[model samples]
Target: MADRDTVHYDGPAGGWGSLRGITRIFGKELPAPGVLDTLAHQNKPGGFMCTSCAWTKPAHHNPLEFCENGAKATLWELTTRRCTPDFFAGHTLCELKGWSDHDLEQQGRLTHPLRYDRETDRYLPCSWEEAFAAIGDNLKRLDPQSAVFYTSGRASLETAYLYQLFARLYGTNNLPDSSNMCHETTSISLKKVIGASVGTSVFEDFSACDAIFFFGQNTGSNSPRFLHPLQEAVKRGCRIVAFNPVVEKGLVAMINPQSPTEMLTGHETPISSHYLQVKAGGDIAAIMGLCKHVLDREDEARARGESVLDHDFIARHTHDFEAFTDKIRATSWEEIEDNSGLTRDALREAGEVYVEAERVIGIYGMGLTQQVHGFDNVAMLVNLLLMKGNIGRDGTGISPVRGHSNVQGQRTVGISEKPELVPMDKLARLFGFSPPMEKGLNTVETCEGVLAGTVKAFIGLGGNFLRAIPEQEAVAEAWQRLELTVQIATKLNRSHLVPGRAAYLLPCLGRSEEDRQAGGPQTVTMEDTFSCIHGSVGRRKPASEHLLSEPAIVAGIAKAVLAPNPKLRWDDWVGDYGKVRDLIEATYPQEFRGFNERLFTPGGFYRGNSARERIWKTASGKAEFTVPKELSATGFEDRPGRYRLITLRSNDQFNTTIYGYSDRLRGIEGTRDVLLINPDDMARAGLAEGQVVALASDADDGRERRVGGLKVLPFDLPDGCLGGYYPELNPLIPLSHHDVQSKTPAAKAVPVRILTGAAASG
Candidate 1:
């Protein structure tokens, strides 16, 4: 193992440091001609939407609206280097499997369709027709229920719609997506409370909000574009509160690159007027505490002949208020303080901020979603917002910050394992086929099916499925059992390296590359976190002429796999993507009406939200409040040497893709094999700074899951809570330890035992 470098990163979130990182990637990758121009086009009208975070673009465009990571995503896709046939011929699959994920992708983009040759242990070039035929044959051999179709968030709305449509038409509803792993809890909880599965507020609400509550989301590294709005909100005296285990630099202070004065003078805009370091798996308790204080204040106000609770709105548009308050009042402050790892004064302060604000926006991410009680965490936040009648109001609503650019859009276009969510009747009417009604597999269920030898074939649109899934070794073993695996991607990842009995890599056009079909240059649409649907058209030439658009690839497979159906025009749809949009509009008339024409409009259009209109689509015809059964914090009380582990992404990385080994914002450099633990926990565990340790799962499932050679770094974290970089620490998470409702892996809160000295070196 190599020695890791650790340094203190004292600079503000986005300054010269961020600019340097963006230029460094571009300098090394050396993208194609006119590739740099794509930056100017990003987030602008009639230009390509960023493939980075799902932060909504402002109604008015700026000259340089793109952020640092956005630039990295564009340049990463537009790299000049190509993985041609010659490159594959020189390196066998076994040889390539030894390379690090970063090094493998750094070799450059895949330029052709390649099939794995088991005899030679090599991936050789193959024609697109042959590849598609092989996939068709595999599908025909297996039962429709035995195949899982996975969609990545990077896929365009058209591609995802067609992908799910093909799966359902072929008599299967097994449409799993990236959402199953990340924000499924948000969808499940919000749908139960607000009758909708998405955020209720739009980008414009940011300016009107009096207070913004950020939970478990690192706006700086994960979604830097959000910092701009937050900066403006702070300037206008808007109170910003952050709740997380780690105090992120972006949430602490941010330096806007677009502001010349701040950039020149090193003046940083402070974010998060109040920062609360909630322990892992303690969000539910913390939120309940806030609600408890709010309800108490409301009672006091009522006694004084003043109304603090939105009585008029609650009486008109809500349900189960008394039951919800009963639960909140029953929660003791002792439990809240013990579980939340904070004082009652802190909870009271947060509640005071919430009470004083006229309008508030609650924003959260995976930090609250990747836990056993993830749904409850989200529901508690909703419960607090409901007390003030925050929903269906300007600048006051719930916002679940999505990680992917089009993740929400993919769900909107029917990329779900649940068949009921898909409009089968609409599809049958439009395309004249009996769509599958049987429920399919989610990400977790798909992995279980693979392990059980039930799911024989897997087709991935664009993602590192094996690495992103929990129980890395078990997932790898399941992959080896599959009959066939197909990867449609732009660059090489670990999933491509682990071939099944037969695997094929089909390279596709990236987001930054032009997708010119028979109809000429085309544009694709994406729905941001705010439900704003907009068009994204690429100006840069394709990295390789051989690369096909994702939609085209899905169409080819569909044409080959499904039996002849007169209503389905796979070829025609591939020739012109607008036809796909037209069909989408026809299928989802309520949301996508005039979708094609709206793409030409400035800033695109908003997908009208029913919850925002106060039209409750719930069982009671009103917004319902849910009460959590238990508000206790999670801890390893039975196990002596155990701590709660929270997996995190590095500043330079997105999800499982590592841009670099260093997490510059956290003062780490040159390596990712370090763990961030509370200094007090380190002392209790008899560990010192820079001491190497091995983390073993305390899941007690009789499976030995451990990651060795992790250096310990003491930092300011809640006691008994440890933090480590993801994909590396993913092995510690068990597939069985997931949320009961959402089925999302509990990556945020894993019980683990730290081993030092000889055990660590092993």
Candidate 2:
């Protein structure tokens, strides 16, 4: 770990501290002079969406709708710094690899197209025509299955639609994206249980709900804008219950920066009424305990000829109710307490709160999804909601908080690895070509394919793929063997340095920059977490004159690689983005009906969820409940010195993008390599605060997975649990350690051994 210091913060989330944060960023990043004027338009009518989290905006927008993190994202995008060909010529690939992720991002936006010069170990400026020609040449030589088309959350819906179209026309379904990493479990699990792949609740539900139950979400760091709603709900007497390993400050209390009263008085509204520090990977067990409590109440109610359960609603709108209750009845309190790390009394109290509320909204984040039983965990939460008839009504439903800005929109436009998820038949009819029908590779499979020398090329629309992926050591080695690598991004990142034999770096316009075409300025749409699609138009000028809009870039690549079709003209789509939206409407008529017209509506349109209407598209035509065979959430046996490793993002970080070294909320500054463990676990491992240590995975794989020189920072985490930053701890996660169903990496629950003494010196 780098030189670091620790301090305690007693203030709530988003207070004067947030104001100071923005001020510090202005000095550090030195953004364009009129950046503040551009930020004012964020999430407003005829303005761009905040490029941070995928949280939805309120119907009546706030003046300063953007949060501190969102503002940071805007400033980060509009920074005055620029990375030109001169910067690339000055540093070799080997030398650039030595710089940290934060330092690389600080180098600013890329200004031109570049190609790797193997002889000089540097990247040289190249024309877009030459770059596209070279990529087309390399791709045609390889089997279509050997290539993987990857997209990040930054890609707009229009861009994503064209991207998937280009890939399918290229004769492959190998389109894997950022969703494969985070919310794949939510997508697959929700579809099975409720016949919907998205959260049923909307932003309005927060204000109308009687209670909100949070599972494994850190609202302060993930999406600070969400804190305002929680604050309002708390003030209005809505109950908030949280279950998480770390004592997330956001859930405990919040001082809304948008509220003039709170800002003037420095008053903090307590968010969560009851906070349960569930152990890492203990969400499933804890949820089971709550279900058992509800079941007990149902039994009592039945004896008295009354019912706490929604028997009428359950009978009419659900299936597998008896089977679900039977399993909950069979579960003993001892097993629940042992695995959940919560006592019977505590669960009963929480259950009482759930039972007392007329309407409750169930909310969760990656804490429940990035696990061995991620699907099971999410399904179990839905089961709890079904018992209380919380499925089809205002202020009641399941909400899986999505992390990326357009991750949901990308999936909406068919950027999935699953063949059955997208309407391939509809696409085939529209394009007059046979689209690929076979299943494609997800994130983990893509990595495995690369390691096996089967996947030869990777084309990334956006994202630092090498850093975002797990098994960093292995993937980094396998990445070098690829025949071609192409990255289209706004800034310089570590992934750009890991070029293949034939690599190209293409610069693209950011979300806040203007995109001009033949028709005029264009707007792209993004789907928020609640299935709401809205338009986003850039306010400022482009970062570089050479940069192209994502849609234009996709069209250019498609033109160069595929055979010209008389029916489809790539040039038409590039000149006017409305043409792209029109095609999207043609493909998915129900969802995108009146696509262009509805996109300009004040708050945009809702892509309706059938589950919310009590219309289950499942086999049984009703909501179903699922039960897990195993009680252990991590699926790992108890072993001494082995702890469940939970990877986390710092307050200064967003996904794989490192804004700075300090984590303000956690009180750790100047380093990102510190481990947070419980005081008891630290002593149990014969460790002390500030001790240099190492972590090694308990995976049975023959390969050693270890990262040393991590400074131990005692925290309020549950015993037998450890917390560390992602990418730094990704090396400790084995490739096979993922959900078998969704193939999402089990970053939340990796069995690892804390190494000290001799091992620490490695």
Candidate 3:
């Protein structure tokens, strides 16, 4: 193995660095023709949505509206390379299993449907009809409740709607999705506090806000396009405050690639005016500290015959204020300072900035949601927003920067495991079938069921489910117990390598590929993070003639599985995607009126939010003020030689997909095996920089979960906290370690001990 090089990057984000990334991906992946056409059409009006981040686009987009990662995602899908039957014929499943994730995907896109051959220990080409027939037969042999249908955020709105419809009509609601792993905490908490599971503000809100606070989100790398609005906000003298464990380069400064002067001068626009390096999993305490400061200021103002709190708004639009205030008053400042890893003066200063601003917007990411207290963390954010009447108004609200391109849309179009959230009666009236009323399995529940031998069949719409889930070895074992497993994907992933008794790999058309049916070329719709419904039309030809559209593949499976149902018009829906949109409009007329026509409009239409209109549909008929309890650090605090571990994505990766081994932002090159630790922690642990070590989880579950050969490097993180790349460290996170309410894996906060020298070698 080659040793990785570590260097500290001192320049601002974006500018030439981002441009170089775009050029490198295109040069490596698209050596063929149609490169310019593909680049021009990305994120344009009536063009395909970039299958990267869920950031909303402007009303009128430039020809080159995509960011660096967006270009990489597009190139990854439209690469000239192909993984044909001949390639699979030469490589056995056992051989492929040894290949790294980057190598497996570098083999290129899957060109045809494949089935595992047990005798040969390889995957061979198979007809789509034959594969679907066998899968349908297996599914028929098992109970509907025994089969779990999984959906990825990459699935378009139309595809997701049809997927849920099929799963519900099949007599089961066993639907789990990618959202369950990432933003389910935001959804669950927001629904309870604000009567909506989504962000209340639109993209335009960035322009009107006087202050913007970002927690646990790296705006420059994860969602590069968002920097445009943020940079603009900074230019207009807007205050930006960030609370994170690491001082991310993106939060420090950003250079707009679209600005000629910035590119020429190498000048950067400052992002965060204040940066607070809070401890990992200490967001709740930090937020509470800020709230306490605000309350103290309010008391002082009252004594001076002035006002700091929005008493009128709070009295008119919220509830539970007394309990909420009492809890904040009870929280001691010393405890807050210890737990948050920040000084009381710093928290007071942040509160002063927040108070001075007329309007503020709070944005967060997985750092706030992927923990044991994720729900409480999110609720605390809402509490701060509600105290100042930041929600349900222009220029102010809470925003969760979603990672997936259409994750919000997928949930909006009925991808939830909860049947009550989806209108079953309306769906039954439209489809002529009684949908199951009982709640079904989520991602975590599905895994448990599979391990218990209850779930026999699994179908993935679009994701590397096995690699994304926690407890890698155990999840792999549970997958093997399944009678049938099917994956609809654009390329090969680790999930396809781990097979069940009968496994099928079905290749589908990517977001950049044309989907031609009996009704000629069809356009799919997507919902962005801001709840804007827009159309995405791919102009490029399909990578392979054998590859099918997601809708076509889902429709085929539905046709085969629910055979002989006269009322179901799967063939008709497959012929024209408009029929799918028609049914969606019929099902959700209020939210999707004139769905087809509105999709053709410039920038599409907004899915109006009741919360934004100050019309709370919550059970209390008003916005809620939730009282957050005290938060405890991970149990490792008392355990000597143990540290809190946080799993993170490298700059070259999107979720589990690795584009390269290097993370340019953090200055690590040619490898992803380095662990970031605080200098103080390194001294206390008797470890030096660049030392190779082994990391072992302190789960106390009697299983030795460990990862070896990690190079340690001192970082600017808090003492007793360590950081490592995801999927590699996913094994250290137990499947049972998740939020109590959201069931999201606590990948952000894990307890582990580092072993060096002879201990590591053993």
Candidate 4:
């Protein structure tokens, strides 16, 4: 690991750095010819989706719609490297667990179905029929509640819909997915206040908005494609404001790699007009401060016989406006400034810019959703937008930038643990079976169940559950107690190493690979961040002949588990995905009314958010304004030697899938074990640059959660805070440290302490 060399990159995002990233991936993963042709088809009509972020594409296609990370994801899938049974035979399960996450994936794509053999301590090849049969037999012997079906965001609408249907028919609502960990707060908070779970804004709103307020979203790394519209918006005089703990390079400025003028002239487009360095987990307080500034100015404007708040819009379309404003008035400037890490004057200046704009859009990411007060954070943001009549307008609304390509779509198709969120009546009528009405376990709850030895089986649709979750060591240990484990994936990951007694690794087709069934070559659909449903048809051949389509694999397992029923034709549905769409339309008629027709049309179609139409599904039948009871966004109190740890993804990573060790954006290369801290905090704690320190959780759970040998690197961050890569720092975040309502792990705000000397070894 090269820890001593720190290169401060000054160039804007998406310049030579992005180009080098693409070339490096191509050299390592896609050495085959015709790769460029396949990449050109990405995010275009009659082509596959980017298969990365949920960020949607425009109606008019750009020659290169994909970004560096997007290209890495695409080429990573199309790699010729194969992980055959022979490769598994060379290493034992116990030995593979010691490898780094990047090295494990670099072993290549899984080309065959594998079954773990305890006798040899290695994975052996197995037929699909044998694997499905064994899984069915194990599931039959256990209670439905003991089995957890976890889906990643990579699964398509057809696959997710079928997966949910299979789980419901199996008599359990234990369908925990990747959404539970990342954006569950968005669904929970937005649904309660705005009557819809998804964002109300469309992609085109970026062009029409007068101002865009960014809250805790790192656009350069997580969703680089978004930088284009933001750059265009800046050129057209749209005021962009950002509130985040780290001063992200992407938000500062960007150079479009595709723009020849920028590349030739080295011109960097400034993104955020104002960047506020708010404390980690202090979003609620900061937003409240903005609200207070606006309300105070509203009072001055009223005295001068001029209005700031939209009284007509609030009275006609919203409820509880007075109570919400009263709470804002009660909050003192001292409390706001202390908690938010921003001065009152700074907030007022940003608020003034916001008030000057005729229309605005609020865009956020996991930063606002992965905290203890994540639900309140989202609610307060909505309150600010509702105060200005930002919702349900042409150039205004909220946009929760999702990480996975199909995570939102999975929730839309009933992959939720909460039964009430789905239309149980419609499902029962269509499927001819009584669906489980009880609430099931979420990601955190599922971890608890596994640790307690209650969850007997785990079936993953795509993601690496063990690597992506919190309490890594504890969860991995508990996973060994499972009776059966099944992973349907295209490539090898860490989750496959910690297999259950009767574990099976089933290789599936990638999004870039064609899926040919009995009916014909079929295309799957995914709902983007903006709620637009688009079709994705793969153009490349399968990586291996043995690889099965996700829908086919799901149906195969479902048929083997359930008794032959006349109502559900598992074979026919898998044979023809159109039948799956027919059922999906029948289940959610309002959202997918003309599913097939609209899916094939140009640019697809929007599912339409009721909140966007001012049709509040809340009990009050109007948009709501919620008041904060406290100023602190994180519930934890300040203490000596305690620092709030913020978990982040590097530029070379997407979720738990790490592409490389180098974080080009932050200028950290060849190591993910470094901790970023402020220079003042480092001096106060008696720590030196490149010092290896241990981070131990400060939770009162009586458990010792520590990560050792993290080199300390001085950074520009808020006081009393540290930034570290996720999964490596995930152990420091307890499962109990989550939003009470949304149950999303507070990965963004973990309380911890640094230890030196002999303690660093543990």
lDDT of each: 0.87, 0.88, 0.86, 0.89
Report the Cα lDDT for candidate 4: 0.89
lDDT of 4 by residue, 575-668 (tens): 9998999999999999999898777555668998999998999979999899876676676998998899999899998888889987888887
* Rank list by lDDT: 4, 2, 1, 3
lDDT per residue, candidate 1, 202-269, as tens digits?
98898899999989998888999988888999999999989998878889888888889988999998
TM per candidate: 0.98, 0.98, 0.98, 0.98
Those runs of model 1 whose alpha carbons end farther than 4 Å from true positions after fitting are 1-8, 633-638
Model 2 lDDT tens row, 1-762: 111232346778998888888778778889977788888888887889988899875568888988888888998999999999999889999999999999999999999999999999999999999998999999889899999999999899999999999999998889999988888999889999899999999888988999999998899999898998888898898999999988788898888887789899998999998898887888888999989988888789899998899888899999998888888888899998888888989888898889888899999999988898899889999999999999889999999999989999999999988889899998988889998889999999999999999999999999999998889888888898999999999999989999999999999999998888888998999999988898998978888899999888888888888998976768888888999999899988999999999876766689899999999988799999888776666867878778899999988888888888768787888998888887667777778898898889898777888898899997777878889999789989888888768988999989998888987677
- Stretches of candidate 2 exceeding 4 Å from the true structure: 1-7
Cα lDDT, model 2, residue 704: 88
RMSD in Å for model 4: 1.9
TM-score of 2: 0.98
Query: What would you estimate as the lDDT of candidate 1?
Result: 0.87
What are the per-model numbers of colliding residue pairs? Answer: 0, 0, 0, 0
Candidate 3 residue spans exceeding 4 A from truth? 1-7, 633-638
